[model samples]
Target: MRKRIVRYLLALLGIGAIGAAVFLFMFIRPLPVEVARPAEAVPVQVFGLGTVEAHILSKIGFEVGAALVELNADHGDRVSQGDVLARLHNGEQQARVARAKAGVVNGEAAVKMAQAAVGKARAVLAQKKLTNERKQALLSRQTVSVESAEESQMEVDVAAAELAVAASDVDVAKAALEDARAQYQLETVLLDHHVLKAPYNAIVVERHKELGSVLAPGEALFTLVAPETVWALAYVDEARAGDIRVGQPAEVRLRSLPRQMFEGHVTRIAIESDRVSEERRVYIACDHCPDRFHLGEQAEVFIRTAALDKALLVPETAVEGFDGTKGVVWTVEDGDLRRREVTFGNRTLDSRLEITGDLPDGAQVVTTLHPGLREGRAAKVTEEAAP
Candidate 1:
């Protein structure tokens, strides 16, 4: 009787355990899951990679070869318009100018000597005329021979020729003086050319030569960029080029200064795509660019091509697929988890997605999936943070 009673108790305990397991499986509630709802907001953004560039990039080079004597500017120096940048050796040019000036002086002296010779010739010609007259009188009275009068007349002609030669010398001396003066002017210009000045308000991007270095003609002495003409050359995909247009609003962010966002507008869009990259280039004129950005720095640009007011929006996380593919979202219907298909439009500036499918207005959709969330499963809805 004891053995039979123990067997009955063991059997009853096993049945009770099975019944408890069944009861727990049938009645126990699942963990509540957090959910989100799609809201309406405006979308505004076009993404592209950009590089910092200067609108006015210029190379500073010399027209004449010379040894660099002094360098007044260095790389990264901010200079004003007309500021002196460098100087080549001016001593030789100055010497040339001095020589030219001496030539001018000598020319002037020669001109004076030519004039004096002319005067002396004129006086001699006057004396010869007087002598010729006297000789003529003597010849007429047969007091002097005809040869003597003829010799006197020849002396006058000789003096007259000498005077003509002197006059020609004066003209030649005048021309020499003019030539000397022109040479002096040219040498002076070359001397001035030795001093390089800033052509405009710019920053020195590069210095090609140091002091005492010899530079050749047409060699770049420095590279400069206009201070206020910095721009961004953004490479945008050709597929999205149609949405971009000149004068569109844009925001630029540099990797160096991640905290700052520069406001700008689309200044230009390339008419043709790049042959190699097949990307369209866009130019952005930053309204307020920081001083730190250098040429060729990588940047991210977001162009605002179009905007819609009070558009229906959802979190980007809520978008399960893109490009009209299959998209799924969880919606709470009658307190039960329900999976629904959604169609989306362009992503907004705030990263909110635009939904286009048949979702009930003001219905809550699951932005983040929680553990144990399934169709027909009991779920609790909660608001997700706005991005």
Candidate 2:
């Protein structure tokens, strides 16, 4: 009976050991995996975070200080160049202009009077010359008394002096008139300063001051931005910004309008990079943006630099010891797993690196990592769809 019980226990232990071995064998077996394969028509894109901004923005105000009297434009109002945007309480300036105008009128009259005085002086001088000639002729003939001729000659001399003095007075009056006209022009220019005009065609972004607010010289009253100057300012990482160039096609996704995608192109690239952020500034012009745009709205941009006919791609996380230029990747050759250090290029917007070179002949690069992946292990490879 003891021998029979021991045999039964020993048989049960052997069966348990066999079951454990089978489970371990199944757990450790190499599983099938999807390897990266060259896909037809793969697009390389670079991503950037950006904001809606205008290339030409301005804050305009009055040139002279006064109380705000009239406001013709408000926020979101579109104005043309030379349009009157606002006005200051310029009653004093107007009065000065009016006084200057009256002074100008007076000056015109004074100038005419001076011209008339000159004419009168010329007539007097001519008459005096005739009288002096007649007196000298009488003296030569000895027909008139000596004292009478001398008195007539002295009177002619006195009239000539009076004419010269009148001419001098006319010159002084004309000079004063010119000064008055100059003063009038100065006053007129000062009065015009009370009115503010738009420097260019733009949409009013904000109204800084309300009516009745006293504004100082050069104080901002309206923040204006040209509609045509609107563009997206994207800050791209320097690592991914190398391929970006002007005129490349791009797509924009605004935070406020997440469901919509606006098409655009690379308009400009800043010559100097942002020192602190280590980013390159790239500007994009939206082709089909909405009529209304909020400045500083967050945005995401994807620029298509190149389109590849066939590209082998792998996720960035699958790479090991990637020093930006080259990295180690697992490759499958002859139904076995192997590791290779490969050179990469063109990082896609989806965080995938393109396998450009450095692969063994007949070896397929792995796109996904797995715990069972080991050197010399057999692999059943499956191709994944291009993303």
Full-model lDDT for every candidate: 0.81, 0.88
* TM match of model 1 to true structure: 0.60
Q: What lDDT tens digits, residue by residue, belong to model 2 across residues 108-216? A: 7877887787788778778877877887898889978888788888877787787787778778878888888899899888889998999999999999999899999
* Lowest lDDT block of 10, candidate 2: 23-32
lDDT of 1: 0.81
Which lDDT value does model 1 have at 228? 82
Candidate 1 per-residue lDDT, tens place, 89-204, comes to 87878899899999989989988998898899889889989999999999999999999989999998998998899889889989988998899899888888888899999889
Clashing residue pair totals per candidate (backbone < 3 A): 0, 0
**Clash pairs detected, candidate 2:** none
True-structure RMSD, every candidate: 9.0, 5.3
